[model samples]
Target: MSKKTEFQALDLISAYSEKKKNPSHLELNQIFPNPTQPRLIGREDTADLVPSMERLGLIEPILVRKDKGKYLIVAGERRYRAAIKLGWKEIPAIVTDANEDVCYEMSLAENEKRKNLNPWEVGKAIQYLRKEKRKTAEEVSELLGYSGRYVKQLSSIARLDQKSVMELMISGKPLSVKNLEELLKRKENRGGETISPRPGSGSGRISINLSKLNGRVRDNFLKELGLLKKKYGINE
Candidate 1:
């Protein structure tokens, strides 16, 4: 087997071992939502999933970790909720001994199985991997199947103020990376300054023409930019 396959098998074995020790069943009261879950599941989305679950039953078990006397969901929240909606007494679950980092990673990976995660959700997951797990952009790109360029862009979006991020989440509008980059640029410029370079227009938006700088100055500026990024923990 490939190294990745081997690692995944080991993880399966570990989870199975933990389940044997815990022997959990997903009783309604016993299962809790993950406190740190970043993705939101609207009732509309769950409405569709409920029918499939009713017809086929749960094809996969939800993953959970022990919390005090209860089990907190590590993955498969939609399945858990659908089962509850159908008034099912219990559902299958695998209780694992995964730590906080592993739990977060597992939840992220599980959500990605359908590749339906929102851009904000993707950004948050990448942020967790970068900041919490201390992974590089390349590492996150490989783990999450995002392009290297897009991963850096997502990382930048994650660094925005939490209030702005919260506002975006509340808007519930689909996010485009291009739009997010534009938002970031305006935020950095302060007061939503216009960034377009139009003829016979003035908006007090600062514009830099790199060609105006001498080679040495440009090189030095690039070096300084790198240093600033490193200092501020910006990824690119």
Candidate 2:
């Protein structure tokens, strides 16, 4: 096996060993190390997770690092938060080797599996892997088990304005992935040109026909759609 594979196997073994050592122990002594790095965002739905943990307990262990007899949580912030909310004194966690690059990769993988991360968070993760870990975008995508084009698309989404993002979150529109791509393209064009759409262009229309868009032109089209919505009271 490669070094990476060996490390992963050992990590899993250590996790299993820790779990088997004390099946009923609750005073988990690990102090989460990377507390500042949040793997999950949008606390609006956190209440839902709490009850599940409270009922069945944490099914998965958090990843952590040890420092001075304290384990710092590296990933699984949501699980930790839920545990705290449910009044659990101790939670399960996996102690892994202190490889910053690998830790980051694992963190991203963990989050990617559990929830649909926002574009900004995904972009930040990708950026961290590239800038801090010196991994190429393609390499990062490969590590995350995502396609290179998918990674590039996520990076592009990260560059959208907060207003546009808010629109996406609040409008409750049936926005397909293709629609989001079109919206992003529109935002990019608006940045280049000072052209603003006439007021009341889209009238709050939610559904967009992505097939009509052709590269950069789609950006202008979305801006016009937003303007139309602002002008008219279309609740789509």
Candidate 3:
């Protein structure tokens, strides 16, 4: 289909712009999480999409709203990031009349339509919604089409330190959610202590569980993993 025709068919923007009858394109200044959004744009994905936009122009316009004179992107963060990376001066965008709540819901819906999130990412997103958006775990569960227990699981995954999470994501290895849960349980058992091994617990068999290690421990684990791969000449 033609690009303009495709843009016209995107009912989300058209429905919102129908009243104004004169929606204008705007630059993306702010990006906000869509509560109902599902898709996530990783670095590699951005690289691919940016080149595509440079070649074809943006087939779909992003949705946004005016916020204190700056445009806040309610949907299409991936597209925005791609445009910025491609050095596009102006992007086709549809101004939406959707309220904050509606925008958030639409964004979340858009994101969720993609493939499922990894356990760790899901955990982070759910926790962000609960903490930043002030939504209850139950509320997030309902909105995200996840069970309350599942939402809690995601929150638990988010609690792991950043270094550990990134290592898992980059390793391209499948992590055992059960193992992670056990690790979380162990960390909790330490009475809210940090994710690191306790100091001076010397020779006490520090009971290292593969799951709960984050930050430095996670880094160390990756290093050790590399050594093991070299030592054993393992290839997968």
Candidate 4:
């Protein structure tokens, strides 16, 4: 995260105090995830949170909106999940009347500062705001107060294959921006096909387009590909 982003996130955190005019308790089972939430709650990421929440209680109240008869979570999902795992019947929440658009804005604001989103998640979030909210990449960039290039990079990451994404999310591999760039390059160079498994297949088949090459040439190419994968830390 950039310094500017850090400051913006702090600004939103401070805004929480200003808008926290109504703090009350709601049944844990009554709260549902916002339909437009972009953040993915992974078990690995939230495992330690349960223990911390048990020891400290909830430091900040979750932001929620009343929908139908149930409450919809606007932000603080990690904390909310922690509270649930701790067997809390009721949890502290700040009820707000913000509409869906405003709720999504607040969710993004909180996520930007938290710095917990992986690159794929960041890309997907950017894409989600563009399509769901009908905002352009430039507009989302402005909303984030980030550069257009950064927005484009995330757009690229969002296009990665589901298999690659699943591996990245689960493997505990460090995906630097440079690694993301290389992945994008490989994707683009293939013109449409990727090394990932084909969709809708029970067995994930890695399709290599070697029909045009002879056996000797294909053998040499495979040798070089193995070396490249190791250099890039791409697990087979």
lDDT of each model, Cα atoms only?
0.67, 0.59, 0.60, 0.72
In Å, residue 169's CA in model 2 sits off its true spot by 1.1
Q: Candidate 4 on 1-236: residue-level lDDT in tens?
A: 42145423345446668655557888999998776776754623668788888999887889998889999998888788788778899988988787777777777777767776666777787888888779987677777776776777678778876577666647765665556555666767854323232346334436789999999999999899888668545576
**What pairs collide in candidate 4?**
none
lDDT of 3 by residue, 1-236 (tens): 10111211134433664534454666544444343443432523576687788899887777776666567776677788788788766777777767776566565554444433456665666676777789987677666667665666667767776566556557775654554554566655743223223456333433456777778988987788677557544453
lDDT of 2 by residue, 1-236 (tens): 11121112234334445553443333543445364362434633567788888788777776776566766565666777777767777876666666655556566555555555665567667676676778888676656666666677666655665577668768885334444566776876643321123357545333547887797898888788778657544446
lDDT, residue 14, candidate 4: 64
Best by lDDT: 4
The weakest ten consecutive residues by lDDT in model 3 span 1-10
- Per-candidate clashes come to 0, 18, 15, 0
Predictions ranked by TM-score, top down? 4, 1, 2, 3
Candidate 1 vs candidate 3: the TM-score winner is 1
- Residue range with the least summed lDDT across 10 consecutive positions in model 2: 1-10
Cα displacement (Å) at residue 159, model 3: 0.8
Where in model 1 is the C-alpha error above 4 Å?
1-24, 40-45, 133-148, 160-174, 187-236
Candidate 3, superposed: residue stretches over 4 Å from native: 1-23, 28-45, 175-236
- Model 4 lDDT, full chain set: 0.72
